[model samples]
Target: MALSNNNSKRATLGLGAIAVAGLVSTPLLAQDAHQLIRDNCVGCHTESGTTAAPSFSRISEQRKSPEGWLMTINRMTHLRGLELTSEDKRALVKVLADRQGLAPEETEGYRYLLEQNTNIIESGINQGLTETCGRCHSEARFALQRRSEDEWKYLVNFHMGQFPSTEFHSMSRDRPWYQIAFNETAVELGQRFPLHSKEWSNWQAAARNDLMGRWRVTGFVPGKGEFAGWMSAAKTAEGRYDVTLTGRYADGAALAGEGKATLYTGYEWRAGLTIDGVKMRQVMAANEQGTALDGRMFLAAEREIGGDMRAVRDQGKTELVAIQPAYLRAGESTELTLIGQNLAGDIDLGDGVVVEKVLSRNADRITLQARAEGAEGVRMARVGTSKQLSALTVYNTLARVEVLPTDAVTRIGGAGGNMPKVRAAYRAVGYSVGADGKPGTEDDLRLGYMPASWSIKPADEVAAHEKDDRYAGSIDASGIFTPGDAGLNPERKRSANNVGRLKVVASVADGDARVEGEGNMLVSVQDFVRRVLD
Candidate 1:
């Protein structure tokens, strides 16, 4: 099947440009964007003139979420004979995000869900819709979409046709799903989130802002620590932005970074940078107003540690910026502080969240005692109209514990020939079950990230009998696994000294309740069997 083609077999009502953007390069007047197509992509993709692969232009022609591009890249690599290194994959994906990504204006109300940060969680547009739509996939996946009612109906039809058993799924089987989708869901979805909007038109017509100045950055990096910093970005060429960052982690360690980025559809952002000797990547959304960039910056080496980042202009007027430890247990109360500029007045902690009393307040900071009282899901952390999403989730009890990256990888090192060791930081994600008492169903709630006691053991008891844990590595208090030094042990019967499968386990003791989760990792001798691309 072709990777991407414009409604090759499906009906597509002209919904205007799915993702809007101004051309960044010089106006070539002919074969401009196509030249780019042939330059980078034509090596593999081709137009239907008589080829098996779809044209590169088809990709540029359609609009999609970053997830869509990732799914495509994953498919191409695993199934369609595409080859790439991690860095190469990142570069290609960033290129597509800028070249064929959604406009920030079109994605305004959806930013909360789209942001890849820990301070927030997925929230549905409404209760009923949240259950009907969000139960299966992320709310951002749905929020990033816009369609006519008929087109939305067509989507349901497509799902039914493509996956005939979908209607029989637990979420669907419990209700009149098909009927509701055709009547209530489709109609309401179109009204609540229509494919056409004046918001996009206005933002698209407005003058674009250049991100070529000093920016104040605030964020926390999981595992390593929190940081405050500044950056200066210079646009070197069309769509090319170069950034220099200087910052300090919470522990006062010097942090620095430089990065190259390509702006996608004007607002979609992706970049790679290094800070404080750590190599990382940035996936963010640029606001239409051009005041801020909010997203996640993650370690590039592995799915180890990541956190949220916000970059705003230094001179811009600021209000209550953020809430430290933005969450608390329902019955228990904790002091929540707001960090920002030009702050004042009483703060509204959104629905279900109650601030018992303001402990203190100042121009840039406000400390207050608040209780969640079992108010699960999210409430806007609001100060008037200004608000950040997923302010809090208070639960009566922890429903379930999950090990993020349910699977992981790390290499065993020995001698001077061993490659650099990579560590895995496991975090326990807690959830609260709602009325249904089901872990994954709609009523289930997210408890954000929770502290856990960590341990490591052999995933296989047979491997344990082989003394895998003894030969493997050690897990630290914060869930970091330091693999045993790379080397084959002469005492072992196997020729290889220290290679085996391990289970990283995290446990949390809450009074009489003990919650635990585990993830599997294979301690390999090498980074790759046959390294392909870099």
Candidate 2:
């Protein structure tokens, strides 16, 4: 559906430029930064304390992410008419980010916003903050910053002065909006995210993880399936790495690429790579121990087509990351690939399963032909000292099928418009009911993604009357839903666009039976204003 104009404006103003530039370890010395700040900011912000604007010391009291600092600078440029060259802006952003950025621990739960993950739903938020601030923008927008109690109060007043209609909005009109925001919400935010914290202090003095070696990569892309590979990195400059990724999909398709990565706030990793001719981005964070990098990787053009990535540092230790085609049918033989590092020695596939022949063996990968003899539950696979719990499963019969996302959304676009269509990807998962003999219980054996026939239909009477399934979109055999074109259609009752609420159905063949799974999808209108935050 179309967003309200107020929210659209808020999103446009709140979300600044996408922070994807290659950053340096120290963009500027303290003296150089002071000179640049004086040249660009002292016009409105004086050296000493003033009521008109915050001074440098006062501004430094808060810590934020690189994107957060960029947004603040963009606000100054757009609203306060501050002028700075593109190069100067980048330098200023880098300086501010390094000097006053949030600790890696501070950004723990909010990394999804930085990764631009669209499938998540916000929950467990404070009701007051939801009504006061979340009505216009995501809660992560504010949660990513740290401020003093007075600064939080000042923010509430600033919002009131800037957007006078905020207090009179739908969810605000019935209550004392200003009192709740200024008195209750601001106080809670300040206590929860204090400006001075021990975590930040420790982080400022701690060493950063070195990204200059080989890493084992394992990830699962929603419609494409699982992939495993290796990433090698060499330090090109301070806080920068030249990287290469060599891997393959579960089907043995070659997946290789080269990219440059920038480290921000010590642990935040951002990289741009071209893999198999398609450009992609990686948003990950290095653990404090430098053992692993965990986050999401997506297509640069379409962030929705992405997957969760886990990269373990190759430190001469044996590790089992994943097993391709983790499940096998009982009484059948299948070729299984074990992906990891330093793999060697004896291979175990639990009881009722036999490793008939070894196809290949290597330090990082092992391929073998295995036969399951009526094994009916999860199995732990072991390679020497490395072991993965529930790495494989053998099932005799299919219990049921389930759609990956029980609820999903897509937007129509590209009808002479600037906005591109947002497609939805899905996967059908199978289950075996396990020892519980119940389909949806905890003991139910979990099978991996399965192939299915995809279709769509009206969800309810209202949708049927609108012929939503006929106009909304089409689902391919691979379970990718491509929305219809944008703009008004004369065939509809009120010349409406192709928007609808439909049901997504997946049918999986199981011997003589057809196991079916269903999900709900809303085909909405194109979003006119897009931003990095959302």
Candidate 3:
């Protein structure tokens, strides 16, 4: 597989600029094919470059057929399905055909030496070097390995378990037997150290330093969600790291999960996982804490909830200060009473205004004003004490308090009149009724006073009261408290006078207040007769 160019560790390699420059040349030219092959293909394919498969120099020396080269290109492109574009294929084929494995005619030099290398030999040697000795295994470890070929193969299997995914496996398995034999010798020299001049110190250093700080997950397991974003990992003061990643899940839900992680100084870490839930898996890492992983999701259940923002209370609050009644019927003279709490002196209700401006310094009680439609009634007044309870206040428009003609005189605080005084009372101290039964004014019945329920009756008028007539066994006929009509005297046992004697008994059998004879007596009847005569 092609290496991931977007790997985070690429930054640590310090080869970013060199790699860019190396690949900067335009794809090989079809017309100047020989020059293209000389400039590009020859460097990694000479006898010195290859130890197994024949180099381009050997091919030129042996004079291979053109069909062989064409077959090679077709296998690599169509069969292996490399990503090389058609233009790249054309350019490569043209160059190879023109070169025909020709030897260079350049003068002897280091550049000339590098121009005659082979892909098969170089690829085989690199693979052997990586697998047998070690990519960056400490020299101390390799020096101990003095085993034979069979022993080496066994050891190779062991190391395969340790590093199966690297380039080592490809060169070991993919090539022919001759290539494999070539790799065995290459591996021996690499493991013995000092036996080979090539060194991977820079590569090892890059791998070590690259694995710190933040990284983005670039790939994942099959059926797993896409891993395409960066995540942060920071070392704490205590030398512990906090690794956090934020991305979306397979189901498009937001995902944010974290794990503690540490750096590895070897090959790129292969992300692992432990299944947990739908679209969710635990990360696998080799940190001291646990195995770290990529491509796992942290999803929460869905919800459809809402919030209300209007109910918050205010502790430092002010009282409702003023009120002006709106849209009163014209000439109706409606009344509004204001009871000031923690207010100043009396308030003024302007003329033609039916509202009251009564005020009070006392926070507990307020003097209220009212308005009415009386021919003679005062408008605009203030009624309150001069004490303030904190800073709260009330302002009101006071209309005149008037008595109606149908209103029966009732004793308020043991007093009654057409218009009795009214006032505000603090019931916490005691109970009191207003003189007119209206609240919050001087007419208010003070503490220790009880309002007397009374009704005035004219001399000829009947009193409106429930009479206690248990002993008399009779109710006053004209009294408002009479249980029934004046003609109803149910217990008298009389008959109707309109019918004859026998018929009269039938008519008044179950009824009340019926006359049986001319002399029959009814209290109301007697009273009515007496009044007419008098």
Candidate 4:
């Protein structure tokens, strides 16, 4: 993997060098973790006190996510020349993460980084920290850790010492960087994220949840459709599970898979599975109470092609979670599938909508032939005592159309690059202007996702002059954008890579009229270092 440009140099320093080797290794037993760490790490990270380096006790003073510890170990391997077998490195990371990991609550608001959600727009972070730390790497890197004031200050010194260029970076050169980092930023970080907390203590004391048995699952894949399923977990090893999922999409397409999951910090759930022969990965968190699992699942090779997942333990309680094909054309009949746990009882599709007949019924799902009539508005679907708000919408016509994400990004890769290209998916959402008679007003009704023809064009004059739309990428009929190849192209001016700034347009057929929606997209260079976090 090659660094794209000079701007990424500081980010590389902050995030550490990518581990080119020692990533593929045989798994070791959990009992060997301590021995592996002692043999490989004790020389520098001593057992008792700091001598050549910090002691294990000192290292234990800080808590971090598994990715954080992995980066630290990777840094040691690349910088300090600490050599270890792949198995040993993996064991060290697992053991240290278990022994000195953040509590579940401590990682809130930053899970997107761990999940590799690249499109998130970070906000609400302190300006001081953003200017000092986030300029190089994501704010999530520091936000996910707990440290003492002195440790935070020590980190600032370490950065400056290791990367002297930090003092000359854009934000650093204008201010007393070290002084502010040491006195104000470190103090604020310590106060905000102390090494000691009741949450951590309580989490440590609480019993870990056993993720075995069946769970009701619901998810929505963008550009695809909503799906409902059930997952079964069998204990394969301590803190590990073998999972099987069975379900179907709203269009009645079959969805089934088998995967393996490893639990960390008692709550974080990581899994890799092949669903319908397509490889996928899941980053979810089991609730402390052990009832729900919620997070994101995406393609292992293409992280952009995934969906939001929500699941609950199948405890035989009637719970309505979702209604597939959630929108209906007023006065038109359609098949509806209600998914949840122990689904039973009289069915109701709110007012003006009637269930013509029950197609199928089961403890986890219910299929019905239903029709909407007389009105255009959001409807709550009910099955017995369980009801889901806004589960279904009845719309007469679309007053306007909007792209799901107003802004997006894709990467050009696969020209002898280690990282594969990241594709961007789009969906056109239909809306009714509602009784307020305004398209963009609060009362506007969200009809739902609609099928559309997708196209691309230059976003601005510069893009047009550069012929970006011709070289950047292509949007297919299904609204998936596949970027052009990586590396410089002789056809392009200056031999630049096939990168561009463009517009993604979606056209939806609405009777005699065509409703159009447009979104901005940037076809950028490939990421060289793909870390566990970010």
Candidate 5:
């Protein structure tokens, strides 16, 4: 992506010049890509060049996913006090994601793990992984990254250097940390995941897509419930987009909004929106190949508390994009529809799925009666060779609800601060027992993640006395919380609804059984403003 403004001293911030210098993959978007870094980063990150902080060029050698870049920026802000507007932070994250982000295919097999907080301890995992990497952090932290073996080696060295006692840590001392990391694990990691792959390279070279049209959107926010909306994207400026979203929260509340966004790397998407007076932030990925745009949208100030944001052009090319419901109960029938470009044909719903007949067919939609007969896995349907679609045929049975992220944080608001109160977004995943009669075994069926009714209450004795119900915030049926403004009134001592620990609950009903999962939420005062005060 080429920025319209290329002559400013700050223009060097764009990867275009560097791409030409063969420093990295061809940059997709330019201009505003690295404005945040140019304004605050260059002062020490590059201007100092060889000081304690590494230069941007040095850091550019490494590749990371969108979340990885956010982690780095967050580390800097928290430790080094890097200042940036939330908007700038969002843009900077998008810029780095475009330049260094990993392709979905690159992080395959780990999306579910990275997405949900899974229990690796009692679960089957890669040999030696738990003892080595999992000892200090989550697999989600390491699994999504792509780096050359040497880069991985650098990481190992960095870890040991930083920790000093890493090798002597109980988990590593018993095992040869360096020997396993450098020889066996490192080699395995390198072979399985390398920084340079055709996936990222091709994605890097693709033309930036101008998302100017209507889109169909579906996603669930933990505290807000499941929402379906339509968004209109129109080009408002070079590389900048204006968006209008209209929809309804699952509770039947009207949802409507308008926002602005910047598209980077032909796929990395960032948008600032407002819905019902709540400011929101969106970090989504657009897959041109799949002709789909999907990512997360959350409170403008709190990213962890967001919901999935997915969209397809109100209409597109010869693509069999999806099969609603994605699965069916064996021996049961479901009326399935094909959503794609020029979707036409005798529908094949997959093994054990027989399209009773083509109920209807339009240029962009096709409907059929499909029956699932004892089918249990992914099934692909094809219309001759033009359309190949995939869906799941499974047994619809209540299993267990797996809450996502394990934990998340939401914050209280301040005096007229643009930082609208943050709401925690939770995902409820349902699973079916496998052939082994267990819910977690390899044979267990995946029912997918979804939204649920939300509830929140005090999680501790302190919260109980503080009367979190009246102070922390009130959680909606969708799990959204509108925190009490900052300040201590007669009801409290602290000068704010600044702090509270609450339990965010997601309740999902599977037939007659109502299942619920809980996660912790730390509702505190504004982080950035508080940091600034410090």
Candidate 6:
């Protein structure tokens, strides 16, 4: 079977002079032979030659063994009317043998030319297609366009309808022929080509602005299908801002910046990106109220962006500035009654600020109270469902004191009447008459008594005076006696008349126990009690 020319080991002439001689062989230099074949013989016979004649140039790069070269030359010289002497044939054989190897100079030059042309092709293709197409279409567009030659031609034509350019139309017809001629090369080269140019370049230069803050958006008019929205971006910190936006696109994505602010404004803005088209505006006016540009928005359109001159001020609303008692004392609690008007129930007390006390609930209003540990006076930041964020301060101190019982005996007064009674009280030295109705003073009578003069002596003095006869008899020695009426019964009368009016005194440590003086005398409590009983 004949092998295909592409798969065969035959060298191509286009590869240059180095591969040219590797196709055919010649003998050694015994005579000028291979040179003569190129200059004189090749002027006639060639495989690709017409009926006029063929030259050896076409077959110079075709592989030939030494035996094949000799046989062909012999046939050419003898059978085909070519005349070569034996020495000429030997030289021709050597030339053909030299052609079997490669030449370093020719190979290097050929590789250099190939690389240069490849760079030109790549650069031209990128400028026209890849760069232009990427301005509008994402990398994903080219990634999904893997197709056959015919299919790719159709896709190219579709894009030409939108961006009819001279270069785009040229590919519409030639691409298919090129694809079939060199399939692999066509596919690789085709990947670098562009589908649309005008649409992509226009989108590349289009101006845009990034936005942030709270926003509200409305749908486009019916049959319009275009999206429109309102964005409010506020400067948050030093030259930074927060942007919020609400808009819709055919593609599904929410267009909004993060909660914090960024440092940029006006021309120096970051680009607002989305699958759908975007129109952004910076809030030139202050976020506060009553200022000249309180609610105005800076407009961003096509290539230029500016602020709206007509200002719209924010509606005035009351905010809860502060709540009292931001903190509670340790182990201490308080009830905070909701007393302010227009207070929303959805107000949020910050973490650690739990609702512990609720006073009452009614249709018109709600009374609420909360308790928390002091925790070193933590500030309670207030957040509500509405836009009113407020700060309520609560502060407290910790203190403690000792408590005592009310019913202790010591608290009531003087260790309740600890002093002795009159019956147990000490008395001074003295004597008295007995039942025999005679002067019966007993010298040894060791009695607890009071002196007739109502004086008191120490216990030892009274005991010693009672034992002395002189002292005991002194009261009797002064006795001046008179006889009683014979029949009158004077002893009974005297006994009945003598009433011992003893006074009693009692003392207490804290004045709850008392002592009393009768007329001009100090007294004992037992004697007084006895007299009162009598």
Against the true structure, whose TM-score is highest? 2
- The residue-by-residue lDDT of candidate 1 on 151-188, one tens digit each, is 67877786688778877887788888888878888899
Model 1 segments more than 4 A misplaced: 1-209, 212-220, 226-236, 242-260, 287-295, 300-322, 350-367, 372-377, 384-390, 437-442, 509-514, 525-534
Residue 301 lDDT in candidate 6: 22
| Candidate 1: worst-modelled 10 consecutive residues by lDDT | 2-11
Model 6 per-residue lDDT tens digits across residues 93-120: 4455334311121122222121111111
TM-scores for the candidates: 0.59, 0.87, 0.19, 0.84, 0.58, 0.16
Candidate 2 — which residues are off by over 4 angstroms?
Answer: 1-21, 24-26, 46-58, 221-223, 329-332, 350-353, 371-379, 387-390, 393-402, 429-437, 441-451, 508-514, 531-534
Residue-level lDDT tens digits of model 3 in 73-136: 5544444544445445445543343233211111112110111100001123345555434333
Q: Please give, for residues 236-288, the per-residue lDDT of candidate 2 as tens digits.
A: 87677888999988877778989888777788787888776666778898889
Q: Tens digit of lDDT per residue, candidate 4, span 1-534?
A: 101111111122244322211221334454465456567777776576433333464476688877678778877887788887776666666656666788888888887766655555578878988899888778788988999888898888988899998989999999999999999999999999999999899999999888887888888665456778888988776567888988887777888999787677777777777787766778888898888899987666555666678888877777887777678878767887778887778888888998998999987788889988986777787778763443688887778888856777778877776666778767788888888888888889987777888999999999999999999999877777888998999999999989999999999887678888899898888766554422
Question: Global CA lDDT of candidate 6, please?
Answer: 0.29
TM-score-superior candidate, 5 or 6: 5
Model 3 segments more than 4 A misplaced:
1-199, 204-212, 216-221, 227-230, 236-240, 249-251, 270-534
Ranking by TM-score: 2, 4, 1, 5, 3, 6
Per-prediction CA RMSD (Å):
11.8, 4.9, 45.8, 5.3, 9.9, 56.5
Q: Which regions in candidate 4 have their CA more than 4 angstroms from the true location?
A: 1-36, 49-58, 220-225, 329-332, 372-379, 385-390, 393-404, 416-419, 429-437, 441-450, 494-496, 508-514, 528-534
| lDDT on C-alpha atoms for all candidate structures | 0.62, 0.79, 0.27, 0.76, 0.61, 0.29
**Candidate 1 C-alpha error for residue 435, in Å:** 2.7
Once fitted onto the true fold, the runs of candidate 6 whose alpha carbons sit more than 4 angstroms away are: 1-318, 338-341, 361-366, 393-534
